[model samples]
Target: MPQWWKEEIVYQIYPKSFQDSNHDGIGDIQGIIQKLDYLKDLGVTMLWICPIYCSPMDDNGYDIADYYQIHPDFGSMEDVDELIVKAKERDIKIIMDLVINHTSDEHAWFQEALKNPDSPYRQYYIFKEGQDNQPPTNWRSVFSGSVWEKVPHEDNMYYFHSFSKKQPDLNWENPQMREDIYRMINWWLDKGIAGFRVDAINFIKKDQSWQNGPVDGADGLSSCFEFTRNQPGIEVFFKELREKTFDIHHCMTVAEAVGVPYDQLSIFIGQDGCFSMMFDFNYSHIDITEHEEWFPLQNWTMQEYKEKLFLSQKEIFKTGWCGTFLENHDMQRSLNRLIRNPQERTPKAAKALGQMFMFLKGTPFIYQGEEIGTINNHRLSIHDFDDLNSHAQYRRALQEGYSEEEALDFVNRRSRDNTRSPMSWNSQLYAGFSDVQPWLTNNEYYQDINVAKQVNDPDSVLSYYKQMIALRQNPLYHQTLVYGDFISLESEEYVIAYMRQDDQQTILCIQNLQNKETHFPLSSKAQVLLSNDQVNIQNQQLKLSPYQATILLIE
Candidate 1:
């Protein structure tokens, strides 16, 4: 039986930049409520909203201070309740971000842990004694710093954090801490939320050895990922987590699980797996180096990207399911990343990329502003950026002997802020995202690419996405589009072609991934179902224009 979640299309909303209702320059629950109809019109079944919990806004609400309270910048709990009820009315389920891997330093548990080393709360977080007046281990944080931060006025005491210093890593080794996390999860599930998008859940379990890894950069500190990401015993915690919370509530879960090997796919996402699905970052991070550094972007070919994506799809198809996403809060816009030629970054190219990913054998996720083909933001200076990771990358690039212009260029091409820009609803003062200045700068191209200009236009990227969604949801072809096997078609390097096959029908999706025309042999029985451009089919040969994407149903 096909799962409901598998057939559902998800839309991710980064609350801060989605829309502002109170003119407070920050997006809120009310703003989301106002956009419910828009999402419904876009045909998404679920909304995976980023964290809106009470926080100091460190890491943009990922450093949660209180799981029970809503962030003031967003709105009160009443607003959230209204949003849930309203979104449900629109047939859209809400999925909140589960960030249990860590908590804000200001969280009561962490504050108590810091106040007295002997407090029971101290056991809730990881704390270690320093050696030789230095951090216990030489592990580097994800945001480019030592993972250990020394305790102020305390003798040789330090705490562990995988990301920001303000976010303390939770000690899953403590049974009590695990119980608390499960309880909190259940509480939210009981509130009528459909599920959760688990954040960095793989980093919860750490290697007990606490050994330093090989230093891969000039910082001398080793990457903490080896010591904390997807360790041996992590499955135990995952099993427990599902049994206690998700399993009981029958909630859908998609994990942001990096470093999970192909062999472990069944354990993480099958029938007995911990999550319903997981996001595969193999193809998404293709432009970056293996170390995930932003500077000196790695050169990649279309074939390489195709191989990575195909491998992931094939492996996951063998075990469980996958979450197909090209853009997220943590990634740059897909239009900017996928289309190499800036001149080809048009509505046609955006529609081509959208159609290419929508029919893959998985649940599709569309990030905010992705429907209208949002592109990367090119800020003039490093000071203009807001993401902590961007600043870290800039400094790291400089430390690696790159000039300021080069560092900013790298940031421009890969910064998370590129996708974090306020959604361009209209050509109003702040791109219709807010009445006043938005929390983040509006993309300069909003004047031409805003939703208001494309909402009703048949040729717009937004309209094309709606058409693709409708095609997927159509009962006549739903079986083949949703549950069919993915078979990669052998084609030229620049052309990506695949067939989704079932016992009844075969749906072929092909794309010209370059800025030049291409030719591919086509079956005479193939019928055009959808296309981004005017494809020429003559004499059993299909002529594809620049960046053309087409879908055909083979009779």
Candidate 2:
């Protein structure tokens, strides 16, 4: 609503797996530059590249070793400059991933903090003494083990990490730290980067009391939910951040916010709130269990999924816009996760999901490989796993009286590594991601679902996404899709319908969540704008096929 972001279509690229130009077993900025035309042709207005900063890659690129330098695995600073220039030439805006919540333990500041107790950098990160030889708080690391790790040569003192021990949480309460982060943000904006996808930003602030919450996991440690997550006064930091950096350059920011309450939506993404939009995790959390394990997920019904997604859309429709996405680097494939019936999850189903979200009153994001309807990684042994979270969960599964094979299967379904696999550019070896062995294994079905195979097929999932994106950005419909009022429609079971209404025109979007044919009332004559399956209006009723998604303009 503030500017052009509402009309933008973002495409997320996991740099390490996107494409390897150098064939160094890793993707790089040059590869992205080479594919800029492809993205532009697909109607991608903006690109969100995951962290390519200098890092140890302990948790991929989230653990930054240096904010100013580009990781060698990604490319040189010159390559980044070239990417920005090339992307701009193709009218594609580049959105950097902002991961300021923490830094790698190998970072200079953290290294300095470890060696010198009285150094100014010591206060840059959270470090405190233990109580009775135990950790200050019984908090569990998101990756695994205790959140507190003993600082070498510092008697009984330890540092806290919300994620892996290698990624230590920064002390945002420190004014110098906040100033440094602001400076870094401005530095990137000054370098022609359009905006940022702020990562784990909600966890920047903490309660500081280090009080233990109710133990919820098999381990004695408690989840960070009640203790360190979404503490009071985080808005103060957000406000300053926007004023000092984003506001100056009018940069767009989408935050990876978790645990934010519905009541405070305005503070986080209001007219003048923290970011342009924050990811709504209500639907993403639908599959997790009470013990926070993915093996024994809660039974999720189609009605529940619809209600959850609708609640998010309806809430953000008030003050700000929603950032609608089905899959990202952190989650499983959208179609694979949502459509339980493997037999019914055809290319049509993926297109239906794509159309349903793209037409919604929000900016739609297409993750790499998502356009082609890639599924999750196949069964992986513990030896083949790379993600720290997956390793932790697999170990937990084994401890929960499950066999090794069972644990592997459970982790296979929920591991973030599923999304981290190399992008399938073609049917070639390594799916044309790299000439050498990729950092991770490529999905096996790349032979049938690669971009090279789909780009020419008009009925392919990729082609459908291109059409959906083009339509969303079409001159005649852009205003209606971007600024129109969102109205939830309730007509039939196993169907989610909504309307985007503007003064000039109204568009109706309907999707059949089930794998069976269904019918919905359609009184007036309507024209099919876009649909996954062939459906027509007859006798004042619309016939929908299995997993159908239809958009209609009323006559």
Candidate 3:
């Protein structure tokens, strides 16, 4: 190792929605290989692809079956090896999703467990008889209902699923299971992947007692976060995982940990802990109500938004590195969903969002199409959407007596399917994602925001992202952006501005949040390094025209 990842900009590719090279209507590894040049042109140094492992597709590849085998739908293991080679040739590191929290109910391990209670594989999964007609405990799945699923063969018995019942939670209590996981991690590392993005990692270690979680709502489903978030013994599991897999090879490991508390974060991701970084989900959770329902927002208070962001920054910025993003495969597009004013295309607003997180002393992840200022569509019906979360939420809204129109608005505004829309390669039919039918419908906005048009436009979001990537890697900002301590520039409203300072220099980044003019007072003479605005920065008092962002060089 080179600490390349520490200084790199990662682009996340959700394969199924990325490109369909063979026109198969599904994205495969070969398609990813075909798109390497496109990714290269965008200036991403690392590629973090969602899982391509063999899966049942119950939860869209999260329900893994064989860890060692690539899904046939995605292409062969040879294709994987070839993609790795092709990516490395373009100087891009590749990281695969490591979803070890659970295996699909269809996985051989689970089936074997179901067949014979005495079988060795039974030890790898959680299996117990339901007590008193209720789930073994009240821990609810993050999806909607109880986390436990009763095996058909074993009457009253159940398996834990943090999401879908088809995905059974693995029993980390078994030493044999831990060894197997370590072996698999080594196998992947040995194959030369740069690292892993551990999925639902906080759910791996649970309360061994499987005790009832405290009731936090009227629904009666116990809050899993109370007992499931960063359990007392999870660090040991991660430290062991790090020691056997990451530390040994020193591979980079980032985690999908949403509710990881501030006090326990250092232990979960510090230098000696489980991962190199953990994604900050609080920003995405902004739209969520106290009941975790889709409550429409007339406006996001600039004061409140700034304070919520600062809480995450203040907690993780010092003790541990953070992974920042506006959207991902599991969330709506940032520009389309978060902006109060969608008509502005608000590159300034988008850039300000970027400025808020990118300069926050961490590795920033860019979801595909996000670089092109992708937005979510409000017209797609519930029937047309393929996302499970959207479907579940729609049903819930209907059950709660919301009218069809009312439910549609909430679902459209918040569905993760907004981002799952196919990558717009061109203005062609199907957005050039597939020559055949696509896995998901492309947002009609693709006609204006396709990669073909933006790839050639210097003022495009794609170009701006490339420029920011360059600034972060540039010698001046690399050290300062990565290891420096982040400090928020206290402001009244309309922006989230911050400074990253090391011994050498301090990099100030200002982003405008409102769809109106905003100004930033810079104490020293500053040079505009990067700006979302088409106009040049002339005066020292930063002038931002609605959602404009400027990264500055100040002494």
Best candidate, TM-score: 1
Ranked by lDDT from best down, the candidates are: 1, 2, 3
Judged by lDDT relative to the true structure, which candidate is superior, 1 or 3?
Answer: 1
lDDT of 2 by residue, 1-555 (tens): 257888789999999999899969899999998888889989998999999999999989999999999999999999999998988888889999999999999999999999899999999999999999999899877776888999887789999898999999999999899999999999999999989999988888888777887876667778776666678888898889889998999888998887677887877797778898888887777887643567665689878888888888888777776788888998888877888877776888888888877887788898998899898877647888888888998887776678888888878888888899999999998899999999888898889889999999998999899888877878887888888988888866589999999998888999987878889898688888888778777898899888888988877
Q: Candidate 2 overall Cα lDDT vs. reference?
A: 0.86
lDDT of 1 by residue, 1-555 (tens): 436789889999999999999998999999999999999999999999999999998799999999999999999999999999999999999999999999999999999998998899999999999889889999989898899999888999999999999999999999999999989999999999999999999999999998778988787888888898878988899889999998898889999998688998776899878999999987889988766788797888889998888888899989999899879999898888877889989889898889888988999999999999989878999999999999998988898889999999999999999989999999878999998888889999999888999999999999999999999999999989999999998899888899999999999999888888989998657889999988688898989998899999987
Report the error of model 1 at residue 296, Å.
1.6
Least accurate stretch of 10 residues (summed lDDT) in model 1? 1-10
Q: Against the hidden reference, what TM-scores do the models get? A: 0.99, 0.98, 0.94
- Of models 2 and 3, which has the larger lDDT? 2
Off by over 4 Å in 3: 1-3, 214-220, 289-300, 534-540
Displacement of the residue 440 alpha carbon in candidate 2, Å: 0.6
Q: Which of the numbered candidates is closest to the native, going by highest lDDT?
A: 1
For all candidates in order, the CA lDDT equals 0.91, 0.86, 0.80
Give model 1's TM-score versus the native structure: 0.99
TM-score of structure candidate 3: 0.94
